[model samples]
Target: MHIAEGYLPPLHAVAWTAASAPFVVHGVRVLTREVREHPESTLLLGASGAFTFVLSALKIPSVTGSCSHPTGTGLGAILFRPPVMAVLGTITLLFQALLLAHGGLTTLGANVFSMAVVGPWVGYGLYRLVRRLGLPLMVAVFAGAFAADLSTYCVTSVQLALAFPDPGSGVPGALAKFGGIFAVTQIPLAVSEGLLTVLVMRLLSQSSAGELIRLGVFARGNARQDGQQGDEQGQDRQRKRVA
Candidate 1:
């Protein structure tokens, strides 16, 4: 959800910025460690960011002044964890604000809080919960992505309701009206996003199995076994050389 520029009151803007600062800051640290520890992950990280940028850039006008689009954060959140996606989502939003003229700098904090911070965390948590409950990977992925996209809009509705309550019924009425309107377009979009995310994850499972295993997306036992086999093969080669 991209709240329009200066749509939120100044106090709300300040509060949102303050609320979002720690998450973004911690995300930076998490991203830095990921890159420093695993240089090969740079490409994957870039891919995740690009995926977010492209998907989110395709914004559709929703009810009121805001817009709705696929957050594309669930894939990154699942692959690298929510903290890394936080950085990626923020960057995507920032670029969109500057280049695409989609969202405004004044409302960047609220946008980031809803789309970047909350969306990823909700998705990642849902994914983990689903997996733990013995659900299939694709199913869990779909659930996570679906929740992430819808949750963003839900948060956006809350933010808008807070800023502009209904004259007749107050905050609750405003929330209901905004949320109801959002559901009209958002539900289908969320389902589409979830399916798309599942497709992407399937492709990654095929092409980037090793990296996924390294990232703990796949089971660690397989990686450990593979490492042991490699070590044994290396020892055999050394013995042959000595002989």
Candidate 2:
């Protein structure tokens, strides 16, 4: 959810910015180290950022000052970890603010805190938890992606409720209203995003098997299987070329 510019009160905006700045700074450092140490990972990093940008840019009218959409943070968080996602999410929000006007500069911090910070961490946490519980890889991926999308909306609802509390009923009342409104669209959207993320991960497992293994997405046994499959495909291609 992109909170429109100037929608949050001035004091609230400043507080959010302060809250988000440290995370963003830490993310930058982590990203730089990743690229410098593993130059080949650059392409995947770009792809992750693009994935978040494209998916999050698609917004549907939901709440008064915000809209509901897929966070697309889970994939990156799973691939590169949550610290890297904080940076990617911030960059995604910044560009969307400047070009699409989907979110505003004044409210960028609040938006980033919700979609970039809390969402990725929650998703990554669930992913690890499920994987630890002996679930399948794709199952864990779906759970993580679903959690990420839903959590973003939950945080946004809290942010909105806090900023513009109901005059009569106060913060709790405002929270119920915003949370209810968001749940209608957000739940289905989270499910769709989860499935889509699983599909993408499957494709990556096929095409970028080595990279996935290095990133710890695939195990050594899977790597051996992938290597054997690669050898077969290479032999087939050579035979065709000779013919």
- Candidate number achieving the greatest lDDT relative to the actual structure: 2
Candidate lDDT values, in order: 0.82, 0.83
Model 2 lDDT at residue 113: 93
- Alpha carbon lDDT at 223, candidate 1: 38
How far residue 232's Cα lies from its native spot in candidate 1, in Å, is 20
Which tens-of-lDDT digit does each residue in 61-171 have in candidate 2? 443445556678888789878998999999899999988888899999999999889989999999999989988888999999999988989999999999989998999
TM-score for model 2?
0.84
* Model 1 whole-model lDDT (C-alpha atoms): 0.82
**Looking at candidate 1, what is the lDDT of residue 214?**
72
Please provide, for model 1 over 140-196, each residue's C-alpha lDDT reduced to its tens digit, 9 standing for 90 to 100.
999999999889899999999999999999999999999999898888878878987
- lDDT at position 238, candidate 1: 43
How much lDDT does candidate 2 score? 0.83
